[model samples]
Target: MTAQPNSTEARDMAYHLHSYTNPRKLEREGPLIIDRGEGIHVFDNSGKRYIEGMAGLWSVAVGFGEKRLVEAARRQMDKLPYYHTFSQKAHGPVVDLAEKLIGMAPVPMSKVYFANSGSEANDSAIKLVWYRSNALGRPEKKKIISRIKGYHGVTALSASLTGLPNNHRSFDLPLANILHTTCPHYRTGAEPGQDELAFSRCCAEELEALILEEGPETIAAFIGEPVMGAGGVIVPPEGYWAAIQDVLRKYDILLIADEVICGFGRTGNMFGSETFGMRPDIMTLSKQLSSSYQPIAALMINDSVYEPIANEADRIGALGHGFTASGHPVAAAVSLENLAIIEEKDLVGNVRRLAPHFLGRLNALERHPLAVEARGIGLIGALELEAADGAAAGATGARVGAILQRNGLICRNIGDSIAFCPPMIITAAEIDEMFDIVEASLGELGQQAAA
Candidate 1:
């Protein structure tokens, strides 16, 4: 059906250029204009509600229409609408939020630097790594290694750090110094007959090989998501992080845990780093930090990563790296309140409680014919799709996504994987309902195929 003239969809087709969309198809089909949100549900313009299976992009820890966050923003905006952290100027909200993040860190952290989004936070982190390298007089130690299919962000530098091809294709990205090694998906990356342990060791060996090929003295850092999010929710095989960390230690390389999706109770723990045995020197956080209520992201550095940079800055008289909205008081305020709600309500506990049900339902999908594999941890998971009757690679997933949308669930299709990351506030009953829709959607696909 075509969009009515001057309608919201029509205007969107006429004016808006969406990200990650096929523009031509959007012009023909228009958009699903979300009107408002409450709890784990969002209503479209025509008042159709969706379960928000992806948590508004794998964030929104405390759920939507959270009144406390609104109140926090209002109070801070009224008291101090805007402030910059430049020239040693600081505000209460930013200071409090930073302190809160540092105190809540999975490992010891020295300082928290704020940014408006994950992209900027990663970009800033890379710059800091380069800065730290320069400060330590190891200017050649600047190449940062990420993993294949890892999702960092979309900025020039961060996009390069990201391991996805589309993120780099035609964007002239990956600049210089950003490299990608092996992805640790046992089913996808391992050779035939390779067990999880062997594959895990192979991943580490490949990483070390890459480091040696690049000259280990030149490798500055290795960055990764604790549980790969956009890369089809690929949970690392057993002993994966331990093996990887061993390599980094041998080379004295820093680890940058991109906790944008795995932070803030999404992964059954406060941070994915705790869930996995990752000892990162620097960490980039966003998405759930403020639950996308207000745009905010932060980077935390341990003393091992910060001291040399601090000394270097002291010698040079400045760090000279930051974003204008680094710690916007209102954003920081909402984030602080968001964290309070997560703790006071024991959202992490909720995740731990419901994760078995969530994963049970997710893993059960493997019984379906179209399911190639099922993977996940905590509250995040995905059912990978195999094309029916030799259809295109992602065709099955695309069809499943459309069916789930019509069935009142909004989830994301990353490549051929149908990801379900509902809000942490979701109940056990809600988990059943969410999977009911998913199961029915896949069943419908089967029915259509059989017919």
Candidate 2:
């Protein structure tokens, strides 16, 4: 039965329209209203606590209720609450954050363009790609190729770049000039005998073939996540990035690394690009940029990508694009504090030290009857459930995920893969506690299935 009317749940049902949720079901069951959070855990309105297993959508690197971040926002709000970056106007925090990001980027990044979310950053990246192509007098070079099962974002253009079917289902998406190639999930996509290297080569060949068929003149860029998140937390096969880079270089196609999920030490390194050996022409960043304390994302473009755009802007009398809150001072302030916290506390090193324990427990889950595969790197991992024979795809995993939720662990089930992305502040004991709940949930599901 649904919660009683006049309750918080009922109030939410009355007005809230949630993204990525079945509205009918939400109205019936109501929402789990989170009232407070501390460290890597959140409590519901009823005061029930659950370990945040997916780090609140693979963001929240520094965890919740971070006082420093709160103070940073307060300080910024008190000093200068709002500002716009349009028309060459800027703020100190925004400029400082940009310089800090450029200095720390894995590869040389020349300029930083701010946005409010990963979607906007990626959407802006698409605009920049087309704009740069036009500036270079190659207007036909505008098609961007992403991969199947790779997620960029949910905006019109970024959603098109996203390879997941649901994002494009009834929206008339995948708007013109967007192409999808193979996903480099060797275990899932590879033929029985094909090795990882061979499968990687095959993926690269497929991309090259697509470029050839479309004519290289029409292909502008290729975008991918260092570790595909929101798409089953897919970790690309060995040599995947190297092979893909070769094809992009051959065609002179720009590479955009969607670091929305993989930035800020999620993958043990400072950025997933460093972990995966991806040398991108542009990088889309968000999520952990401010640890989700404030909404912010940025697109970093190399000098080669920025110069033509600058020249064209000069020619056209203006750059002609920016968001009203492109670099909101409060957001920038929070992000600066977030970055400083990560550096001072060495959360990246914490992630490195705890990776073994996290991955060890993750890999150990494969022994469970429902676990088909356990794969991940750093503090992020996924346990792919083996749907029972004759059961619908993803059905079993969904049920198990629900059970895990009830048992006080909040995670995401992408198809049949249950993803675990605990906060960087999580300790080894908390990791074990998180995994313990998962194991118990799996055991319960296993019993239910046998029944």
Candidate 3:
């Protein structure tokens, strides 16, 4: 049904230029206006509830309507609503968050830099990589290599680092000096007769080849998500990270782990780097950092990466790169409280406890008619569906997503895979509820297709 004129949906259609949405399509099909959220459920404008399977773009770790995060924001606003981290000025919230993040880092991070979102964090990481290279007097060591299908950010630099072609198509992006190597999805990238280990070797060899072709000294950093999220949640195969790390170590290349999606227990561990054994020199984090109650992200760097940048800053009298809201006091306070709640409630342990059931329900989708492959870890999972012949690539999955949303579970699809990453606070019963809706919705979709 078309939206009523002057309603929220129609108003949005008139005024909003939504991200990752077609403008013309909005005129035909207006947006689903979400009104409020609680725990793991959200309600649309019509008061229909949804399971929030994607956790609001895979961020809300603790879940919606987390009161502690609300109180943290309120208290901070009443106290120090805004402040800047420029020059040497700092506030308690930002200071505390930086220290806490450095302490909680998977690796030995020397310092933490604050940003507003994952994109800004990644963009800053890339800029800092370049800055550090120049600081070390190796300006030629500037090119950064990210995997194909990697989704970094929408900014010019971060979008360039992103390997998805759509991000680069009209923007004339993926600017000079950025390169893309093979993605680590062994099932898709493997040769006809190749095994998992062989596929892993091939990926590493491709990386080494790219590095050599570009001159190892000219390569500054190689960045990747431990599990590719927006690029269809592509999890790495066995022995993949080890082999890739070996190549990076051999080339003396710094690793930048884009843990925007996998951080904060979404991957069954505190950090995806711990799950994957990735020892990155720099790590970018967002999404679940503040449980999306506040828009905040962080970049952490080890001594090796930080020393030169600090020295360069000292020489130049200013580092000369930061945002006005780089460490907004209110955001930092919410983030600190969010982290505290995650720790106090042992959300990571909850993920570990529920992951088996979650993945089991997800993996069982392979038995369904529409599902071709199911891959997941912890509460984050995806289903790749077999589309009808002659249909566009994502057509079937898109329809399935629509059906699923109407069935009271909201998920995001990338190509043929419908992805789910529910809030960490969701109970075991709710897990069953979420998947129950999934199965029924897919069954409905299957029936519709058959008819």
RMSD of each: 2.0, 1.9, 2.0
Candidates' TM-scores? Answer: 0.98, 0.98, 0.98
Q: lDDT tens digits, residues 1-451, model 1?
A: 9755788888888888898899998987779999999999999999999999999999988889999999999999899999999999999999999999999999999999999999898899999999999999998999999999999999999999999989999999889999999999999788999999999999999999999999999999999999999988999999999999999999999999999999998888999999998989999999999999999999999998889999999999988988888899999999999999999999999999999999999999999888889999999999998876777878888999999999999999997899988989999999999999999998998899888
The collision pairs in model 2 are none
As for lDDT, the candidate ahead, 1 or 3, is 1
Taking the tens digit of each residue's C-alpha lDDT, what string does model 2 give over 1-451? Answer: 9765698888899988999999998977789899999999999999999999988989998999999999999999999999999877899999999999999999999999999999999999999999999999999999999989989989989999999999999999989989999988888789999999999999999999999999999999999999998988889899999999999999899999999999999999999999999999999999999999899999999999999999999999998898899989999999999999999999999999999999999999998877789989998999999888898888877788789989999999988899999899999999999999998898898788779
lDDT of 1: 0.93
Q: Write the per-residue lDDT of candidate 3 for residues 53-158, one digit (tens) a residue.
A: 9999899989899888899999999998999999899999999999998989988999999999999999999899999999999999999999999999999999
Total colliding residue pairs, candidate 2 = 0
**Candidate 1 at residue 92, lDDT?**
93
Cα shift from native, residue 231, model 1 (Å):
0.8
